[model samples]
Target chain A: MIRQANAVDFWRGLALVMIFVNHIPGNYYGRFTHASYSISDSADLFVFLAGWALRHLVGTPERQPPTWYLVLRLGGRAVTLYAAQIMITMIALAMLASVAILRDNPLLLEWHNAAAVFHDPIPTHVGLAAITHQLGYFDILPLYVVLMVMAPGIAIVDRFAPNLLLPLSLLIYGITLAVPISIPTWPVDGQWFFNPLAWQLVFVLGFVMARPTGIGGVVRQHIVPIRIVALPILIGFVFVMRYGWWPDPTWFPQPRLFFLFDKTFVTPPRVIQFLALVAVISVAYPTIQRYGPRLVDFLSMLGRNSLYVFCVGSVLSLAGQILRYLYRGDIVIDTVVVIFGIAMMAVTAWLPEWRERVKGRPAPKLAPSS
Target chain B: MPAPFSRDCQVGSTATASESPLPNVAAALRDKRKLKILAIGASPSAGRRSARGGHTGETKDILQQAIRGLDVEMINRGVSGELAAQAAIRIRNEVALHEPELVLWQVGTNDALIYVPLGELEQTIVETLRWLKERKVDVVLVGLQYVDRMAQDDHYRLVRELIRKIAAQENVIAVRRYEAQRLLAQAADSGGGLVPDEFQRSETGYVCLSQYLARAITLGVFGGNLRPRELQNLPPRPQN
Candidate 1:
């Protein structure tokens, strides 16, 4: 039976909300709320849950579908998502260009130029750079696609020959560390905004743990102990960082050993921090599952259709910007407009559920227990 | 060891100092009150060399010896190849550590070489100087010398004017090294048969130039107690 964990859905929904809240300018509540968690930490947990949900949806062992069928299904979703990304980029570029021309400002004109835009505002540059080559933060979509395509090959090894996944993942992770892999930053900049080669290890680890095997069973059983150890370790790491234990390399030459744990490029310390966060979440999962009500259900609904929600949310954000441009006065008014935009997105996200409920089809059980 | 000089050796007459092996040059140069002077900047003040040989002059030692007997301790805290922005980043740690009474800032050269936009460079320098001034650290901003072969064009002039404007607006002492170099070249021309061509053209040109400028800056900061002969006779530049 294809089942989803309500707990996972609730958390994923919460993360999506946090992501949206963080994206809005002047909205610091989300950051403060998740101050204990790094974005990568939340992202790692979300990707892991994604793998777990995939396993549940497709079934494991006895009820497993054929490898080819699984590949086709995952690959199709990836392609569809990638195509959607391209369409969004084209639209965004057109909007930016139109805005620049309408403003008739030299600075805005310079911003439209790829080289100048890349130098001045990197985020927008990365989005535009995606058109020619994958050079934006959205490179994550392509990376996810690659992983999905390789998941079948991984699934085969995972099912019959589970022991191979660890050594192979470790090898890939080691290579990722040893090799200096960087994606180009665009028109003028050469450095990668985010290096996927290093980041892929997190996804691979998620994939390896997703299988209903010995490691997963161990994780399920030892949740409390993992949390007990992880919480202190994470706290200590944060304390060390805050106190400036790592010497500024400009003042003194830093040793190569320190680079092993440097998180500027998703180093091992980041990986440890991510795992620690997951351990805490796993311990809290059961509680969230029990107490989560309508409010949690709303978020889980948003999480279930995250890609669709993100696309709609992005367009709503554009609308919010347009409104602000027209009525630029009170901070209270701006905040209200942002809230209205979020509400609009929320309504759009729940439309399908409302339709299904009207048809008396039990709302298709959006939250599943794995 | 015996006191370097006897209390009686404080005689005004030079005749009293002929017998001492190490005459009281320090006593002669010492003012009653010590002035807390802090010398800082990029590599030029740090007394380090860059890859381009543009910063070959060891101005630090010249400034050090020029103020040696004066009631001032000149601290050199220059890092090699640092732009103004990098200097701004480290100012809190570096300049604040010294608690300097007076800061000699010689930067902006590397920023030009590294192709940092002039606007950013100006902002960084202005903010850094403002930060120091707010902290009550008196600043003496040294303009870049036109030594880089690549910077020999009109671009160097533009950079020099930018530094001048920053110095003026901040109400800091502007040490015009480019003007000083031009004056030195003019002095060499005017000295005709007295100053040898070798002193102006040979590798010693930078040594003499730095020593001369250091003496001028020292005299400007303190009074005329520093002697030109004393600065010229200091140890030779260390060769690798």
Candidate 2:
């Protein structure tokens, strides 16, 4: 069956790749792919795409599963991803420890201890700390799990009680702003490693967009015009931000405009930027669907198995960081190492599909029978 | 010192005879030739005062005035409570704008206080010096010498060594303020220091050494009248 790839899937897949590319330091293509243009906007885009993709894959109002079943499925996925992340983090820590031991540098050893990753003569250090003092910085699994658990309730409200979901989400978002909450950072009381209060807005937004009837469908229809206007506006804004055309005040502690849409908390600037990105991508949907056959297929593979891909990609990047520190020579070698790392991630993503083909397991149908 | 002053006095007297007495006297006494010397330091250089009275006396100004007939214009740009890192950030925009002939860098106290890693501090200093040198500007590094309490600390030793290393590598003048302060402290103990009373009253006070060192640095850079008594104790230099 020749299936039309979902527009949200394409965008979300593209965003995930961008996130990976941006995470890698000094990656040449990072400028184009990274949300560094405006981090808040980039985050919004990721959240919006996530919402769209979830709706597209999980089923809309017309073909909705029971609330309890939906909850179970999402919760299970979240738990699986969390376990996988923990394993990946352990592997990364092990590699870092090996590097430190080999170097004979106490400074490197100190870094591991400071980060709470060092465990020698007893491996229980990582496990013991994982229970009490979670590795917040390197771990997004907990936040993702919380979002997933909340998704079913959001979905139910969207499907059965549309008006209530919109206003309730908006109200919650407003309350969040008024009484800002933060998830505490490890090793520090106030420091939030993942500031859930700020991040929840993104998840809630995704839940709302999962319904097929509202803005998502409207956006998907007018994708072309949105793209034409959005691409130029984004470009112009970047130019103004970079150059002194619209100068940030030197006297001010933080830029006035940046304050409005700061990523430190999910602010209004991010909301606009995300909407703009969505509009532009919606317009380009037809073209992306038509021309980039091979690229789309490869990216779709990444999108379909995002959790596995992300875990593997993170481990590979960590290894690359260790290698770069060890070699400390030519830029060319570093570039080659990064490329190898990316290739490894791509292969790992493709592995499951290859396995499915060998077992003769059919690809899951997009629109399940009612 | 006697010849230069006497020659200038005689010239003033001769000029008053020929020209209108009022205008000629005004011109001779104007002494308005501003010496453009930039004194850049952290808190200590900003804090020094005269031992005698209420008027705060910066050592840079005194040394500049001592060499007044040389037409020296001195600008004191010492900011209080700044480490080497912060100084580096502001240097390109603020400090270098004066187009100073000699930059008297007196910092590193705050760096020690904040416990800035030796490597990072060294990098900041090296980068700062390179930036100045690239513009063909001369730099005279003032070594960080705190009181007896802090002098024995490892951080102070690191800063001292780093300063010496940077000075030698960059081929810049290294003012050994630490050693100079040590000598002054010793002199105060022997009742022969510059501000003996201040030293005697507050044994750990920076008043005497900072003033003397600042004056010595200013004079050394600007060719002033006040002799650097600290430099006299050292071995004689090979005459070029």
Candidate 3:
């Protein structure tokens, strides 16, 4: 039977909410999200959870699917993500253009790195399809698509040479950081907000850490001491983030991406702090499940339908931002936007299961689960 | 075709053109027969052609015409309503990615509008400017637009002044957008014509802006150093 409320679903759901809140810049709720306290925000957690779920999708050795089947399924998922990204981008542009026309404000067309679509349509359209033109705040899915495409290779590496998997991932991550390279956006001449080469490390770390052997085995065995070490690092980062105590990027050596707390490259500081945050936060899942059963079930529902919820939430967040812009943002308006957006996301999540019931089949697996 | 604005309107736009050399740009033009520039900032930095067929591309054309066989390629990375601090991060990333020889940074208005702390804006600009300089990239600081109402706003004045000070201190060319626009408006008012909005949200303004930048870049690069034959193709130096 499908699990009702597990730790993975609960955390993924929480990350989705944080992402929704954070995407709407200047929303009052944004100040309270993980970004305010943690070096790595929902993007990191979301990507990591995606990597964790990959393990479940590929299945355990006893029930492992054929290599060809694994490749096809993962490849299909990547195609789906690419399609979703294109759809959302089109919707976002339509929303922006509609508002610009209704309000007679030509300036609105330029919001979120969108000016190219309006001014330079032909090339920008090609760039958008090629994943070279990503609207701001709507960039994560392209990164997800790229990661998904890399999934087959990752799976093959693990299947053939599991021992070399993480080392290879880390090598790519190191070279990406040391060389300080990024996937450039075309027609606009900027770098990807999420550097895929650098981010694969987090995804690989998630995949490996989700397993019951190797690093994962060692980590499980040393959970208590690990948490003990992690607690202080997490607390220290809270202070570091609160006080803006990061070192100057100029002071850093030639390759500044290595030391700096850059979100795009997923720098070392962010990696270390994020790992620490994970170790510390993992302790709360059991407590949350025991004491907050209703919350867990509600969140688990949303997490189960993550892709749908995420896509819907992205559109809703954009709507919320537009609303906030039209009516100057205030605490009351922000509260309404957040509540309405989240409530709509929950509704979106619930719809899939409702359809499943109507068809008289088992509850459909909306997303990969651990 | 040349821009619609009269030659007189272009005179006395910016302050005395700084004779600072754009060595990288010069070298690129010399060896590769091409100049790659990255323009990054708020709305004004976008030199895209408007629906009304504005002279946005004229900036490239003017540069190309100035030196025979020289190709001027521009990459626009402008996001409207972006603050200086945000643009600084993008500038670094873009510089690393494109490795352009010249960077045209239109700044100040959005930062002033949002009331971003002056210190933060200054630090971000100073650090980024230094970083660009270290990479041997030529920089042109396009100052804030001249808005009649904003002229009285203390923060606006402070922002313009701070950018001017940074440009002077850094020894990079500062396109005196505010001053140039003010001059054009004055000349237009005196001549009994509707002032072409040099910095506002209009195609006419964008056209005039292109000419001003092209003029400034031409002067900053050649600065009486161009061969006499090349000098014949250059515009008359605008008097202060």
Candidate 4:
């Protein structure tokens, strides 16, 4: 089993809390979230950590798990995410419906892309299950489902040809940007909010790096130099974004697809920025764990049960939105919502750990170790 | 809920509604029973609920019901903090993708808040209006939402006048939301405060704005001083 309270859990748990606050469209706390200052926000953290967690959850390349069992395990996680997404969507629609009916205002039905669910449920439910249609602020899980489903393949590649995985993933990502392709949404007709094709690169990087050998190993060996390069990029992006000054797109020559800062493609700047952040943070995580506040343990507990916590956080944030709308967003309202939401998430995390504790099982991990 | 109509604050409420700015929208409605309307820009049209609970969708639903026997499909792509300059560039792609018959843009608030370059904001609006005209897409400019305190804010007043000037120069129907909202405050009980409480969106205010917008559309489409039928059965806010 994995270490119960570590930096991975700490960071992931923090990301969940941030994601919850950020999901609320106009919450007062939004300005304080990482998105305000950084190009890549908690979403990047969540995805990257998911990749990092995959290594710990499953086996590394040296002692790979049985192929069939590994496939089944990854498949199960995917199915769970798929179901969680569908459930949250249905519940969010129900929440919107209750508000609309209770207030006698049909307009709430149209907000947040919930119109499809209300106007036509059967086909839209199909779209929701198929992961083709997603509501605003309720997207990332589908990407999680996709990444988990693809994890076995990544693990397999990491086992057989570790070098091929990143190259292949990058090749696909690069091709998508050059071709301007993405997974499309349904009923509404737009691209998926979190395009998986490009995002899988980060996921693969997380998986490969967690291995003792590979790009991650290289980085661990030369982290000082990597941090030296990364530190400047982070400071530069922070300055540029803070000043509302972005590099002009026209300055790039032809085939500038790779250079653009567009979010959909997970372009160079965002990826590089994220990588730089990771390089610096990874170097400092051990020291942080040694001298961190008591809050770190509290957050790590939430991180240990991330899936359940994330699902609960998503629904709570929606409720927070409704509460914000009804009561009006003041400092008090926002603070109360965030505290209550985090508490709810913490409770959700505790229940699972408590359940497994009473049962005397080794804290029900994601997959059974062979 | 037949709220008293405010003739004084109604900007384009007169007959003709300024040469039927959304001709193609009406034409499309008449020809095929379908019309696509794109709602863009900030706060109001983005279908956001204010502290008072006013919804942009109230306007869409009211227009559909008032026009009677027509399907109005609305695509709301409202990013709350989007500057007019950013929206101007983005709208080109939105138009290319959706090809909406009419575009209802609610802007100025974010620009006012951000203190964007006044000349840049104006140029963007002028260029966007010209582009829409060339594309034969009708547009209605939903100006800055009114907050009583905003009247004293220099940038807010300038943006409001700039929007008014743009609407006149381009000959488009500018829904004077601020004026109507101020009228709403005036029409409310005096103890309720003479402002629309900018923090919360009011359902009554949403209804009022929707009704006014529907009336403006009806006037534009049929060139008559008509109003949406009284939707009498609406629920009031429960006492907290």
Candidate 5:
């Protein structure tokens, strides 16, 4: 029997599309992306799903992986993410440099914080390799890399003292927000676009929620009540965000990150909104999968091969921005960009499965929770 | 005397004169013996593309030369091809992080290129300027660069007009880079092509921009209550 497309992959795939649209700043489609009406955009969903995947990687009580194996696997994955970030950042710089030289527009050289690479290549290059300096629109992976490097720690805590896992994550999240602590950029005095310290809360939430025991089990048991409570928040925030109804920043007390709806530090409001969103989607996705099987399959494929599609999407988004600039981002140009760029991402997602088929090996199965 | 960095640098006088007090910048210079400026713009506002560190180095040197024992720390956060909305966001983040007292916001060119809706652009500029004002941060709105094609575009002209209006309304200093470049380009045109058409792409263009900025900043900090002509004709510091 053919397996149905799962919600995890489907939502992850949709998040990828949202990210693609939002990444291309000034694209006409940007007006309709998830961020327009939601306090938290696809970035939060993306990170949360990544943490969900870590649940499988860490394994369950019945078939837990050895601590050493988990460390090596997560470490290797971190290396891959690091390599991808470095390669893409270099490619992005090269793309900007080529366009700048060819079009006789040096301004292209400076887009998305690439000016540092051109102006101060040596230090910036070091910063790039070290993940201390990240190009705009290309920053999420550095956060992923850090989170992946911390995955072993996460697994150890879950394995040994599972009770303390979430409280510890929340404690870190609280400290990050209250102190307004973030990883600072090097070779440039700035903070990371996504603060991993704060983001790890969402990741840990995903991890814990994926489990059938503990708070995850509790949430799963009371999901209907949770959905009821979450529904108003979801509906309420849509209007709140749309109308700009949040309290004024001036009104926020000191250590404002705790109160403000900040993306970088993953503030409380955003987290609350995102969790409410997830709750609502949990119920809605089944109906979606039943009614829109093809759409579900398509998005599931994108989600299954998220890393590959995301890498392709990042480059494509940059290309889309350049194209929009060159041709002007009217609705027509934006439509073409969105359609073509997403198609390329789909192709990227398909190639690995095609390779597996060609090698006479079955495509790897998603983890049980996934 | 012609500006040392660029020969076609007679545009310094055209920088919008501001009676608006740059209180923080003035105070920083007085007490700390240091000045920190964050230059956030599109292209040459970062520095010259052809000449590495050209505009930034030139601006620093001019500022330091003008005020002995004054340390000028400059931050170049110029992302070429950025629109007003995007730049405004970064400006907030950078200001919050770096706490720069003055922001040199070179805007309008890229927004004009993309034909960003006039009201949207105006709102972003007005909102950001007000936010900066709330923080007591001084802003110098460097207007669009002169491009021949954009000169005829009505939307482009409107965007330029909007920048001027916003600058005046916000009481921030404005650098008339477009007017200066257009005048220089026109003069060069009349003189049979002495200056490059794309002033923003050339070494001279960025050098001229740096000189204009350096002069405007120096005058803003020091030449308070001076008339525009006096600010323009202010005597150069004696060479050591």
Candidate 6:
């Protein structure tokens, strides 16, 4: 089934690699990240893929059992991600603490927002577990959990009132952006970096588009027209990014929030650029797949096992940061770290299949017997 | 131009160059002897981690101990990787919500690390400080930390210089975190530890940072108001 949708998986895999590279913050490799050239980064790609994956996982209402069964399954996934967030957060804190203690750098404890764990462990730990607090890079999962919890509802709406969902999702997104509301952080006061309210539109778009429904059908049917609009938008963003030029936020009669290229609430420019990116890239995938079979297969493999690889990649990224701190990693060292980390992720991606073979679950084919 | 002072400056004894910006603090000091200070910036000022950096902790806890016997209500809103621009947007709301007399802003490090254009960084400082000044909020700009890797970093130097320059131009207190930390390291090296180690710059580093800030606040707020005491002679007590 995933093989049929290898492009999604391949893109997700590409997103994973990008996420890993971008997570290092100040690393030399980060300069090459897509965010430098575009408003949307791998975060948009990853979230969109998540929505696509949800559609794939639950094909249609008829294909799934009961609504309760769907809710239970989706709820179970949310719980798993929640547990993973806590586990990874603890490991990251320990990693920071270990580095701080071993290297005699108290600064490490304060860096990456780990100061709460050392300074005020009780409330910070409680906040982290409650999903009210999150470390710098380990934030997306809590958001993923919320989206998963919403999936059953989305599925129900998709099955029954398909036309209602997108507009409703957009309505909520638009109003939130206008009102400028976001979830607040607890134990420490602030707000979530990626506001789920605005981001859900992209996720919902990904979901709605997978099916040849109203808006999705129209867009898919008018590919040429969309591509014609998408190409120039894509090219224009290249200039915007490279030149650091943005539409003036001070436009009269329009709220500054509407135009600013803000990440917290996925602004219009970001959403347009991201959609354009998806359209343009999706249009070319077929050509690339035929020409570069090996590349597609490699990325698709990583994509197929995204959850495992993402968790490992996130952990590995934190480790990479610590190692960079210890070594003061130069460009050469940063490159080596990235290559080695991606290789480890590749091995991790393959390990499940390797184990399945070792257990004789899916024995290798006997060539001579045929 | 006044050089940024280390922790040893007889801070509280001398009036700050300007009047206090925090009317609430001034009012409380005059009426109830309870000064509620809301320090918001990165982790050192006391908030959670922002997107890029994970600087976290109650830098306020350290300050509470540093400024004991002076009913100081220290509220921290430090978010690591929080730029001055972002803080400026959030600050007005914070001022409305918490209503502190003074704001201690630790800035420039995240901007430097991300290679945000110097002009943008300067604009952020200028705009944020100008807004604070208009609102009569007494602000002390805490400069960036000293990292061995940053010595050769031109961008880092520029950010540090900008913070200092802004403070000088605006007649605001600028706590020289880099110089103070470097001084601590030098002192430690002279005392036999060649490297000065991590705690000197981390735990002790934050402790010193908070002390420097707390002392700056005391000097800024209680200069002529409080009975004179050589702040350098009074070491900040750790309120564990």
Q: What is the descending TM-score order?
A: 5, 3, 6, 4, 2, 1
B107-168 in candidate 2: lDDT tens per residue?
67546643557898899899988877665456666666534555566766888778888877
Give the residue spans of candidate 5 off by over 4 A: A1-4, A361-370, B1-19, B23-82, B87-101, B131-137, B145-157, B178-214, B223-240
What would the DockQ be for model 2?
A: 0.02
In order of lDDT, best first, we have 5, 3, 4, 6, 2, 1
Looking at model 6, give its docking quality level: incorrect
Which predicted model would earn the best DockQ?
A: 5
- Model 5 agreement with the true structure over A107-138: per-residue lDDT tens digits: 56567767666765677778788998777789
Backbone collisions counted per model: 4, 11, 0, 12, 0, 9
The per-candidate TM-score of the B chain, in the order shown, comes to 0.59, 0.64, 0.82, 0.78, 0.85, 0.72
Candidate 1 vs candidate 2: the lDDT winner is 2
Over the stretch A1-370, how does candidate 3's per-residue lDDT look in tens digits? 3467888889999999999998776678888998899889988999999999999988776788999999999999999999999999999999998987776555456667777677667777888999987888899999999999999999889887888999999999999988867687776666687999999999999999998888888999999999999999999999988886766455666676777777888989999999998888999999988999999988998898899999999998888878866775668888999999889989998888877666866665788777
List model 1 lDDT by residue over A71-157, tens digit each.
788778777777766765555445544653454311111111221232234444453445323322233455555556666766777
TM-score of candidate 6 against the unseen true structure: 0.76
Q: Write the per-residue lDDT of candidate 4 for residues A121-171, one digit (tens) a residue.
A: 566667777887677678899999999989988878876787898999999
| Per-residue lDDT over A156-238 for candidate 2, one digit per residue giving the tens place of the 0 to 100 score | 77777776865786677666554544453322112233445566667666756555467556655676777776777666656
Model 3 per-residue lDDT tens digits across residues B1-240: 111223443443434245466788877866975688888887543325532222335667767776677787777666555768778877876676567899988888767653556898899999999989998899988887665556676877999899989888988888777776665555554553344442233333455677767766776666745322333343444333
The true-versus-predicted C-alpha distance at residue B221 of model 2, in Å, is 31
Q: Which stretches of candidate 2 lie over 4 Å from their true place?
A: A1-6, A40-45, A109-114, A119-137, A220-233, A244-261, A360-370, B1-240
Candidate 6, position A82, lDDT: 86
Q: After superposition, how far is residue A166 of candidate 3 from its true place, in Å?
A: 0.7
CAPRI-style class, candidate 1: incorrect
